[model samples]
Target: MRKARGCFIFFMIIIVIAAVIIFYFIGSNDRKIASDDSVKINYSEELASYKDNGIDYLFLGIDERENENKFEGRTDTMIIMHIGNNGKNALISIPRDTRVELEGHGINKINAAYVYGGVNMVVDEIYELTDIKIDKVMLANFSAFIKLVDALGGVTITVAEPLHDDKSGSDFDPGTHNFTGEQALAFSRCRATAKGDFDRMDRQKYLLAELFRQKANFSIIPQIPDILKILNEDTKSNFKTFDYIKVAFKMMINRDDFILLTLPGESATIDNVSYVIVDPDEAKIFLNENLG
Candidate 1:
């Protein structure tokens, strides 16, 4: 009986030690993505009046190049992910060249908001434009984008037309292709289409939808650690590790209900600069009709 008790006590101690080690590693990994210097933005007071029936996240794809500060750059892609309580989720893309009035910079492209004041300015501008209160924000650089696509074993997408853009390094004949990280980036960045930036936004939205479908499967469970490591190195988010896990689970369960949309607008040249002129009221109505 004494020997049994001794053995049981030893087993309990071992279990405790293992748990401590597991938690330590988890905390370490969480800290890697949670930078102390992350920018904090306060949503407008008007957002208080808005009822929150679900969670909204703003994802900014920064256009940072090699050897540049990852957090400082023009936002190449702006997407708002709204997860509704009714099991419907939507990914809405906001054009980088959409015109908006900045606090100090007068009227300019929406992407410039990131350059002028980082995530805070961008979030505020988005709120003003759409009146959608964002619950969290995630900023990812080019490195993160490439690595993530690569880690997922690449994504398969169908190209409707031939693309040949020297600037974005895209050269492909029209067909379906399994895109590598670099190729996917180029595809999203290509502006050689007849619609120019609008076409780019459409491609971006399609790519994101494909990524979601691929990632929401159970087969990617083993690759989560590597994926999280890549995100840790190049992505900054206000979400915790558990928060991500929960969202992933939700996405996996609700993958069938996922949808993609882009803000409605027309391209116009104003003051010798091209911009996507989107009406705020129309944008709100569009989101409500589609997202709800």
Candidate 2:
């Protein structure tokens, strides 16, 4: 009788392990980065040194206003976050309209990589431009952003001035307001100011930093089950178990360690098409200084 009971428990464990493997593979649909490529990045020394610190990941927020099994749209927002070992961090925002050569697709705006292919193609384009090796991909639809913010009980933000954007339903006074996930999206998407997309990017980074602050202030462990449930519903990722652990540890160390920055670029008309012509030299300096 004891032998039969032990066998039953072992069999159940195998079933559970199979389920988890399937879950991981479902999101691990892109492995093109490992394929033979001309682009070779030398992050060996840096990665070895930072092994005691944290890791790097590409956080892509696609412009899919709704969530479903099928997600297809431009990646409206792109940010690469590098979590360091000594409570130091760096975040670089890539402009959606930045010009880049999409694999198989002709040269176009960076965001369009998603429309042409998927996460793999986007990674390819980013690597070609930055020469940074992204360890993981967090592909999130706009709907997931809302769900995630709400799951954390909303985040607070200070509006600098009065603004109204009927297109995005973003109307606010010059004061601090606790914003829901949907309102947060609208707030970040508003472009009534003189800076236009640059202003929007700043707002996005501010909200993102606030989210980190709030997550740290309030214990997220108890809310993990609930928050993860919401995350799974609207998002997909290729993050491994240790990756999640490292991210949590980094955030716990110091949420404010994050340094927000953007690529230096100017608007230009190329063949009557608009693009943000990035200064490669400036970008290289920023990448080497911050990433190393």
Candidate 3:
């Protein structure tokens, strides 16, 4: 009887080991590009670098008010967050106005890549500009951003002015305030101020930073289902369920190690049409320093 019990335990251990191996391979396979997808473009393989710091992922917040599935719009926000390996520290936020050249397309506004093609085109554009390969992407719509903020128990924002807008139905005095779905969306999208797009980007970045600040609490775990639902209902990604799980685990583990930088450039008008031009030399130096 003792021998039989020991054998049974040994068999269970073997099964557990096999299960773990299967999980890892299955998860890894899901993240790979599917041959049938139209966006699957040929590119050289990029090896994962096991390092002390972490990896940088291009976080694109697209304004998909038009074609949601095909990922069409001017990427209103582009953030390259370098999430460290241990999941404890991070720097966030990169402005979309940064000028860069897209792969197969000549120099143009950094945000134009999305309008020109889709996530794949934008990914290729960033890869060409930074010379750093991205392992994965999180493609989110503006509405999803609002839902994420609300899922985190709503985000607090400080208003600098009182404004009335019928489109968003918002009018708030200058002070510290908490915002919900539509309010938070309007707050982040506010361009009524004098600074226009620059001010709007700054506000959006600030709001997002605040969200990240509160996301690390243990209490937020229970809200993940709602968050996932928001992502499912509003956002679109190439990742599978397991792939998202693995990435989420990695993020939770190494939430702290992150360095965020925006592409440095200015907006201009060529033949009366606004264009964000890439300052080649300055951009090269910036990429070499930060991305390295």
* TM of each candidate vs. truth: 0.87, 0.78, 0.70
lDDT of 3 by residue, 12-109 (tens): 77667655655654454354435226334334454233232455556677777766553567887776655544543334344466556666777667
Worst 10 residues of 2 by lDDT: 32-41
Worst 10 residues of 1 by lDDT: 33-42
- Show model 3 residue runs off by greater than 4 Å: 1-53, 68-70, 84-107, 160-170, 240-260, 287-292
For residue 126, give model 3's deviation from the true position in Å: 1.4
lDDT of 3: 0.63
Candidate 1 C-alpha lDDT tens digits along 161-262: 999999999998999999999999999999999999888988988888888877778677546666767766678887776767777877777766768888
Comparing candidate 1 with candidate 2, which one achieves the higher TM-score?
1
Model 3 residue 99 distance off true place after TM-score fit, in angstroms = 4.9
lDDT of each: 0.82, 0.73, 0.63
State the lDDT at 251 in candidate 3.
52
